[model samples]
Target: MKAGYVALVGRPNVGKSTLLNHLIGQKISITSRRPQTTRHRIHGIKTTEAGQAVFVDTPGIHASQKRAMNRYLNRTAGTALLDVDVIVWIVDRPVWLAEDDLVLERIQTSAAPVILVINKVDRLEDKAALLPFLESAQQRHPFAALIPASALRGHNLDALEHKIMELLPEGEPIFDQDQLTDRSLRFLAAEIIREKLIRSLGQEVPHALSVEIEQYQTEGKLTRIAALIWVEREGQKAIVIGQQGEVLKKVGERARQDLERLTEGKVFLQLWVKVKENWSDDERALRSLGYAE
Candidate 1:
């Protein structure tokens, strides 16, 4: 049996979360069009006849290190590469960015074999452009395998999985066969609420916001959850609440639907917007909000 950990690392908005979900055949990680949507390192386990592959979905590595939150994200992404059996470096575009250079430098330190996955090939207008990009990538390092895949459209992913299984070391399954992820239901619920907030609000609000589940109780087939949405200031709170609390209402409704689907049971969700006074820049506030390094 081939069983080991696989780390997915890339810049923000490179479809790392989407790739992980498709690879595992379940939604273990939340995804969004916005960059840096994933702050925590999530584990998605895929067990097949060949072996069990535990995929680590990490926050995107970027150039920004100004805020305490940004530093925490970088640290989270960096730490996942330290002890993985294989690394799948995903990139959305054909051309490499300066942030990709930073990710490459980090990967150079890892002894595990790296597979360069070019994701979102379904959006590429010119098919011919990929060849040159692949050629240039090969000159940089001897990648274990270079595969062009679209995680959203389910293209070339089976081949990617085959390569991953081949690369993993021979061992017994680390997790139970039926398990899909390592995250708790409460943590996933909080992540779902945060995803709705990021999708509903403007670009600026997402960076200033964080979600925390203040209370969670499961009674029979129904779950009662109360969550707090932390914003940096009163004005941001007002924006999140919208006119007559429309924005918050919409976010709650979306989150509830997703929560029900994820939990496969009845859900009673309550969300409140509160001011936390620049939590992103404050180290203590960040730790209180679960951004500890």
Candidate 2:
């Protein structure tokens, strides 16, 4: 059987998380339209009769390393490139950007075969441009395979999976057949809350915020969870809380629904907004908030 690890590497908001969720047939990774919504490395495992693919969904690689969080994200994404069986480099647009060049530089250090995935083809206005773009991408790197796919609409993903399985080496499954991800329920719960926050708030506050699960307990068919939403400043906290607590209430409702679906049980979720004073830029604060390397 063919079984091994596959790293999904790309620039910010290039649909890496969307591709991973589609590949595994589950939403193990949180996705948002905003760039840098995904900050952690997550594993979405897919086991079929052919083999098991331990897909590593990483934070998008970007050029900015000015902040501590930015450096952490780049390190996390670069670390995933090592020792993986296959590298699926996803690019949303047909054309490559300077950030894509950044990703290329990192993956060049790895010996594993790379597959260049031109994602979001369904949205491409010039379908005729695909071939020339693919050819240009080929000249840049000796990719094992070049596939045009849409992770959102589930187009050409089957072909991508087939190629992945083919490239994987022969071995026993690394995880159980029924397993969908390596993350714990608590971790996923925090991510769901964070996703809701990212979707609910405007552009300025998403990256400044982080979610921490303060309490998680189960009783019968119900799971009670309390999550802390950490923002960088008091103004951000006020923005998250909103007028008359409307924003926080709405975020709580949305997060609870997803948590219920994930846990297969009723969820009692509580969300509170607090200030951590530029935690994203503070490496010590980041480690305390679960950004440890």
Which ten-residue region of model 2 has the weakest summed lDDT? 269-278
- Model 1: lDDT equals 0.94
Candidate 1: list runs displaced more than 4 Å: none
State candidate 2's TM-score: 0.99
Residues 13-132, model 2: lDDT tens digits: 999999999988889999999999888889999999999999999999999989999999999999999899999999986988999999999989999999999999999999999999
Q: Estimate each model's TM-score.
A: 0.99, 0.99
Q: Candidate 1: lDDT of 176?
A: 97
Would you give me the overall lDDT of model 2? 0.93
Q: What's the CA error at residue 213 for candidate 2, in Å?
A: 0.4
